[model samples]
Target: MIQRLNVNTEVLSTYIRNSNTPIEYLRQKLPNIDKFLKGELEPTFNQVYALSKLINIPTGLLLLKEPISASSLNVDFRTFNSELLSDISSELKDTIIEMQEKQEFLKEIVENECPFVGIFTFDDDYSDVILKAKELLGNEITRKRFDNYRKILGQLGIFIFLNGKYKDNTHRPLNLNEFRGFVLSDKKAPIIFINQLDSKTGQFFTLIHEFVHLLYGDSDLFDGEDSKKRSKTEAIINSITAEILVPKELISDMFDNQIDIRTSLDSLSRKFEVSKFVILRRLYDLSMLSRKDFMSLQNELEAEFKLIENIKKNSGGGNYHNNLLFRMDSNFFNHVNNAVQQNKITYTDAFGIVGVGYKGYKILSRGG
Candidate 1:
C-alpha cells in the first residue's frame, strides 16, 4: 500500500504560483495535482519530492504548517520597472539564499578576515570612501588593465560572481538592459554579482559601483547608466566611481588644445582602459565636450558597441571551462576546494556549494 504524505497545501500552491514553472506543466507530471492543490488528496512522498525539485524549493519547507513569507533582501532596485521587478527580485532572492548558505558554511571553518566591508557609513564623505578604496586596492589598480579590478577586489575580501542567466533557467539570460550588477550588504562575506552579458568596461564600472554600496552597507541593483533621474545616493556613487577611475586632474593634464575630439577620446580611453562612453562622460563632466557633441558621440558609440556585441554573439562562445572558473571567482572556488580537501565537506556537499555536478566538480578540481 502506498503511504500518502500530508504536506502544506498552501505552501505548495504558493511555491507554484511564484515560480516560473506553469501549473499545467506540473499537472502533466502529477496527474492528480489539481486534487492535491484543492486539499482533496494528500501528496505521496514521491510527489512531494518531485514538486520540490521542480520548483527548486526544499522538501522540508513543504511540510511546514504555514507558508513562509516571501522575504526579500533590502535592495534598491533603481530604474527597474514594476513588471520586471518581481522576476528579478525572485532571482535575486534565490542567489542571495545560495550565497548566504555558502557563507555560513565557510564561516564555521574560517575566521572573519575581512574587516573593511562595513567600516564606512552612508554619512561618510564620498571622497573619503574613494580614498579608502584606492588605499586598499593600491595605485597599481589605476595603471593595470580593467580585469585586474576583480582580482584587487577579491584581495580586499569581496566575493564576486559572474552569471548571465538565472539559476532556475539557464535558457533565459539575465536582462543587462535592466540591471548590470548586484551587491549585498554584509560585513563578512560581502558579495558582488555582475551580469556577464554586460560589456567588459560596463562590468568594471559596476564592480566599483557595487563596492561603494558594500562600503556603505547598502544592497542595491544598478543599471550602470548615467542619468539625471537617478537618486541622490546613486548620483553620488556614480560620480565617485567616475572620479576614481578617471581623475579630473588626469583629464586636465591629458587635454591638449590642438587635439581633436576623436584623438582625445582615443588617448583617454586607452590610458584609462575604459570604454569611449566613460571617457565621453568624463569629458562632458569637465565641459570639454558640448551638450550637443556629447549626445551625438554617445549615440554613435552605443551603435558601434552594439555591432561589436552582435559579432561576438555570432562567433559563438569562448572556452567553457574558463568562463565557468571566471563566473565562480578563483578565491571562492579555492575555499570550497580546500574545504573538500580538508574533509570539512564532502565532494557532494562541495558540488552543491559551487553549483556543479560531480562530473563538473571533477573538471573544476583539475584547474578548469
Candidate 2:
C-alpha cells in the first residue's frame, strides 16, 4: 500500500532559525539536520536522536520554545594516568587521613580564590608572585613553615582531592610517582591536584614547583625529576620554590665559604627541617655544588635509606610507609563526617564507602 504523508516541519525550522550559528556552519556539520531540511531523511525523530549523540546534547532541550546554543555549556575531560604507580601492590592502599588533608587544602582554595581558567595567562616572574602572596598573607603564612604551603595552595584556586587507603595498595601513577602535584584544566574551572602521599617536605616543594607551571599557564603534566632539569623558565621558578622554602640569604650566611658540601647539607637540612637529599638538590640548583658532587651525595643518601630499610625489617614494623593511605583519605573522612552529622548518611554507609568497619570509623570520625 502506498500512502502520502504531510509533516509539520515547524519544530526543526524554528530551532535552526533561532540558533546564533550561521546557516552554512550548521548545514555542513549538522548534515543530519540538513537532511531533514532537504526532505531526504525520513521520520523527523531520527534528527533529534542523531543530534543528541553527536553533540553530547540532550534531546529534550532541542525541542524547547527557544533554540539553545550548544556551545554555551562546557565540560572538562582531563584525565591523569601515571605509569609510575602501576607496580604498586593492592596492600599499599591510601588512607582517609591523607585524603582529607588533600581535600581540605583544595576546598580552602576554591572558597578563597577564583578558578584558574587557563595556564596561558600565568605570571612568569617567580619572585614577584611569591612576594605578592607573602605580602597578602603576611605573617600568617611564611615560606619556612609547612602551614605556609597550605596557605599558598589556598591562594591558588586548585582544590585537592585524595582518594583510596593506606594499606589498600593505592598509589599515584608510576610515571607521576616522582611528581608531587598535577593540574586540571578546562574552558571553565582549572584545578591543581597534589598527591599527598609524599612526605610533608616533598609535598611542600612540589606545591610550589607546580605553582610555577600554573603561573606560566603550562598544560603539560610534570613530575619531580623533570623539575630538576634547568631551563630559563624552570630555573627562575626553581630558584623561587627553593628560596621561598629556605631563603637563599639565610643559606649564604649559614654556609659561609666553608665549601664543605656535606656539613653545609646537614646544616641546611636541620635548619629548614627538609630532607638532606632535598637540601642537596636545592644546593645543586644554586650552583653551590658541582654536578659530580651532587650525584655522590645522592648515592650516599640512597645507601643510608637502604640500610635503614634493612634495620626496620629486622626490628619489626617493616619498611612500608605507615599511615600513607590514612593521610590520603583525610578529606574523605570530612565528607563522611558531614554526611553523618547532617543525618544524611549512617555510620554504616560511611564505613562502607571507606571500606572500613564501624570500629575504624569511630577512630576516623574523631577528626585528625
Count of clashing pairs, candidate 1: 0
C-alpha lDDT values of all predictions:
0.70, 0.48
Residues 311-353 of candidate 2 have per-residue lDDT tens digits of: 7446632222334333324444565577578765466545544
lDDT of 1 by residue, 1-368 (tens): 44565667887888888787988888888899999999999876546656767888755456445665446223354322111243344555455456554554444444566777767876788789888878876665355555677878887778888887654256656776667777766666677888778877777788887887777776653344223323666777778888888888888888885888888888888788777888998989988878999999888887998899888778766776787777876777788888678765567567766777776677677874
Q: What stretches of model 2 exceed 4 Å from their correct place? A: 1-123, 133-144, 151-200, 210-239, 309-332, 343-349, 352-357
TM-score for each candidate, following the candidate numbering: 0.74, 0.51
For candidate 2, the TM-score is: 0.51
> Candidate 2's error at 109, in angstroms?
14
What is the lDDT for 311 in model 2? 71
